[model samples]
Target: MHLISYITSRSQISEKSIQNTIELLNEDCTIPFISRYRKEKTGNLDEIEIGQIVQLKEQFEALEKRKVSVLKILEEQNVLTSDLKQKIDKTDDLTTLEDIYLPYKKKRKTKAETARKNGLEPLAKMIMSQRINDLDYTASKYTSNEVESSEKALEGARFIIAEWINERTDIRNNIRYQLERFATISTKIIKSKKEDEKAQKFKDYFDWSENLSRIPSHRLLAILRAESEDFIRVKIEIDNERALQKMEDRIIRSQNKCAEQIELAVADAYKRLLYPSLSNEALSIAKEKADEAAIGVFTKNLQQLLLGAPLGEKRILAIDPGFRSGCKIVCLNEQGDLLHNETIFPHPPQNRDTDAIKKISSLSDAYKIEAIAIGNGTASRETEQLIKRIHFKNEIEVFVVSEAGASIYSASKIARDEFPDYDVTVRGSVSIGRRLADPLAELVKIDAKSIGVGQYQHDVDQSKLKKSLDATVEHCVNKVGVNINTASASLLSYVSGIGPKLAENIVTYRNENGSFSDRKTIKKVARLGGKAFEQSAGFLRIKNGDNPLDDSAVHPEQYPLVKKIAKDVGKNISDLIGNSSELKQIDLNKYITDTVGLPTLKDIISELEKPGLDPRKKAKAFSFNQNIKSITDLHEGQLLPGIVNNITNFGCFVDVGIKESGLVHVSNLANTFVKDVNEHVALHQQVIVKVLEIDVNRKRIQLSMNYK
Candidate 1:
């Protein structure tokens, strides 16, 4: 078996689970398909674990291909010997194999290789052995070719052995292990003796440090950025004595006069060739770890964002805010159905005028609009003012909704299909409105990154960012159930079993046949399989249906057991469910076997409480001052307030009612140094800021927590 397959088996997980995960993540299958339809085959492994497995599997395949390529190259050069072949086969690591191949590998001309090719191999070997019994005698065996003297002769021979020892696979591996074991990661800043007052961006990270294990991903990435811009210098090192001792023991196993030669060669090799290569290798390892950690942090932040709050199944009046352009208003019914739409300009020309009041009042009166959702973009506060001018009821709340990428979604093909008759601009406004009522449903229409919840989002690796955001969206969608018949392709794609294409198929099929009354009717959609149906059916609910259990997460497989338990309680499944006392007495283990476990049983019991319930609810809405128009509005020491647009590495980006956001630098977080940006602030958190600087010409704004 291959090493990966062997490792997987050693983990005690079933071979089928491993195989299914690999196949689903292979080039042929997409994440949405694998996550939704292949749960049973993968033993319900989620998208995150499934994605990790795919990456590892690819790495394994690449390593295997590389080994063969290396072996083939070595054979072609006519230097492939039995002992070399043995070492290659025994080698299980890429670094080790590459190290062994270093000497024979084709490269540019080096001093030692040149010397060996010119018939000085014997002289070099004698000095490398370090046996003093024939020191001058061994040196005398070779006459100088390029070098003219005894000192030069010894130097050339020493150079040859130094190169050889440097390239040794075992020796290099030993040094790498020792360095990693005792390494003290050091970071320093080469200050200018005076700070760069002109370049204020990098003043915070001038001096920073943390261990490899303890350093936060964002902090490490920040330091790297600072170094890249020539703002600071960073170095990682280990104890030289500890490393040297380990190197001696590892390389000089024989402990003869040859030991001295080995030590000299090892030290020279490390300082010259080995350090450069291993330094890069070690840093790469560090970055990989940082990437993993960053991805993890992003995952948690996204989860909290995703799980934030859903207004759920509410009738909403959404307004896409604009100034010179009139507000785009759409009234969505209780089921998120767009009941009515209109353009109302209650600002400037007709501020509180009778005509404006009549138009706004008529629309609100017609639909009995329960709530108003104002897009938190340009002119949002003005629009909110318009809504407040003519009051409706005390109970009706006005929310300042984040319309980050609402326009992007509205202009999309998916949005067009949903509102083909309406203009894209109008559709955008409608989306802004609906987002307040249900974030999951509306946000799904836009790419997660466009929602703007991350830091250094555009700078980091794009592919990695996209993959992480997509996975987060998928997880969130699965957690909250989707309506089988009414959910749009954008929203449906997020469901456990449905992907973008399949979601479109389901919607198209529904549009052709009319709305589906039951979950079983979903089978007619193209490309959907039995496995997909089994995993997704329970999560998709029908409000008014013949099967009451359709609204719960309880799988159809457990339908019979639920019925049996209901029978024992002298009631039906529909009634016996939802009551905690009735479910508490049921003998769960009697139904338990290999397939069904306590996890599934408990999940079913929770779903029974509120069938087809949305886990999100809206937080209390508050609209800040309308006067804070732009970054130019602020002055030094001014106590201006803002909402945390995003939390990033260096600091937090705040939306202080401006087109361009302002940054509160990391050092300005408090009197003491701040290690992590997330520790001080979070996404969408409203905060107080002291305007530290404002460069309106360049649109560069800076704020601080400490005011002088």
Candidate 2:
């Protein structure tokens, strides 16, 4: 099928670039490695472009495999012809290939197959020819033991003719095209389940009708979920009269004696086969589009959450706020090791406020805690207030970190291994502190889906979702460059070519042999091969390493070039490491070689300017409105400060330091129309929202940024 040409045409990448990228992928090279290290070979293609190439190549291979299956089936049937083989070989689309093979496909016993078996095939052919004037006489000739009467024979003939019309590619494609343009998706609440409590959330979808093409991904997924739960009956349909007219126009050629029979056959096909098939096809396409959109949102949110501002290495006092069980508090050192673990009753039920205050203050003084991290769950607001009232010895910055996946991480095997002696509460508190310290390292311990930042994430395609979120993690990890000496096995696994086994080996080697002093030491780890080292070296950082460039983004292969640049300036490598002026004097053209291009050389110069620096911003302290503690405290028309916690197509959900997060609909995001909610708000962005409406009964808060 000329897969390279097809992929190039589809992806809009150069043929040469696609070929090279496909070869590299065939050699088991990861996208992160290819995009960052093989830029000169891929024409400077980024990860996204490389990912597209990989997807298209995989798709082409799947289609090719299907084509082989189809060809073998046709050959077994002894129906494969040169022209048919050529057609199948020329087309790479699965749908097109399946359409071409539809007529030849074997089916179980049906009315049409039964009709053909009853010797009514000649009558059907006569009717389809549109030349028979005596159609009744022709049908009468085909009457036999199975077909008792001429009417029965004609009925059988009509069934065969209907099958023919259904199998025609032109008619099916035309109807499919019309369906795509005119289809409407309708949902009806099941009468028995109409009053069901679980059905109330889907009230908007009940008795609703919308153009299939116009429905947003989230809305469609919501409706589909309702349908799957049997709360609603969903249907995709088009205008019957217009759809039938289009089908007849494509199938019927003349107004002759057989025209009426052909018309009947076409109508039967529309009702029995074509319409149902095309409606499902339209729905499937819509579903695929929705899946892609949902996956894209999930990927973006995961990336933002993973690359969220890091609080850096600070001795943190973390709390997983609770009520009856008391707040779980853990004091962590700069390295995120649990130094002290205890319970503090700062909230109701066990309100030992005096003792809790004393405990917190004493721990702060003892650990020399630089910051306090409180999980934004349970009695988080009250916990924050309790901590704020304490007059600690240090000017501790308290952060209300999102505890989205802390529970999942705490109960995980990874957590159990890291702290076997501690309970879930202590482990959770440690996670909260570690997340504040280094978000990427801590968050990787849990599944991305468990983190609550997506829209209909569970309802979307699971495998696709996993692939996309995994890619995002890899991208963020490689982008920020992991510290080999300090990064955990989970964090190291996302670094370019390093997977689970290699990451574990590196960690085990480190535990036995101490920290990796340079990038070159990675190769000495058991089972870490040359290719793995080559792919993973550039993204693994070694701070204060034996070699200075190893800490920078420059590949080990380019250490010589940096050395040459340093020698050219008549200075050692250390003298030119951070000296931007010295770097500026050297011509980038002088360093360009067959293997290295200006894009890479320019990157090396930029890296030297900020060696091993994290691209993420520093985590800063944010304050919620102290007066508004919960939903009960919120009032309409009151402007309050909030942080954007989750985003979707329709709007962004803001946490205004309350139990219930408020929704700022896209229409209320700005005075002008907001086409995309993301353009107006991002995850963790601080903004002021005016309370438009408050539903205390539903525990829902509607907010708006358009208010004065």
Best by TM-score: 2
Which parts of model 2 are misplaced by more than 4 Å? none
lDDT, residue 341, candidate 1: 80
Tens digits of per-residue lDDT, candidate 1, 1-708, equal 375574374355566777877766553555545554456667877665666676667667767788789889999999999898888777666787788888888878877777676566777776555555645555555556565665555556767877887776666777677556655455566666226554346556676555655565677677777777676787767666666676667656555545655677667666778777776677667776777666655655666666666666667888887766777788889777778887766666545445655776677778877787888887776767667777664357788788888878888887887899999778987887777767777787787767777654554666787777777887777778777777877878777666778888988898899877766777888888886776567667776766788776666667886787677779877786578787787777776656666656666667776667777655567666666766666778778767777665667777777677888988898787798777788766778888888888668889886564
Highest lDDT scorer: 2
Clashing pairs in 2: none
Global lDDT of each model? 0.71, 0.90
| Residue 549, model 2, lDDT | 89
Model 2 per-residue lDDT at 114: 97
Residue pairs with colliding backbones in model 1 are 36-496, 36-497, 309-617, 310-616, 310-617, 318-433
Question: In model 1, what lDDT does residue 152 have?
Answer: 59
Candidate 2 residue 300 C-alpha distance from true site, Å:
0.9
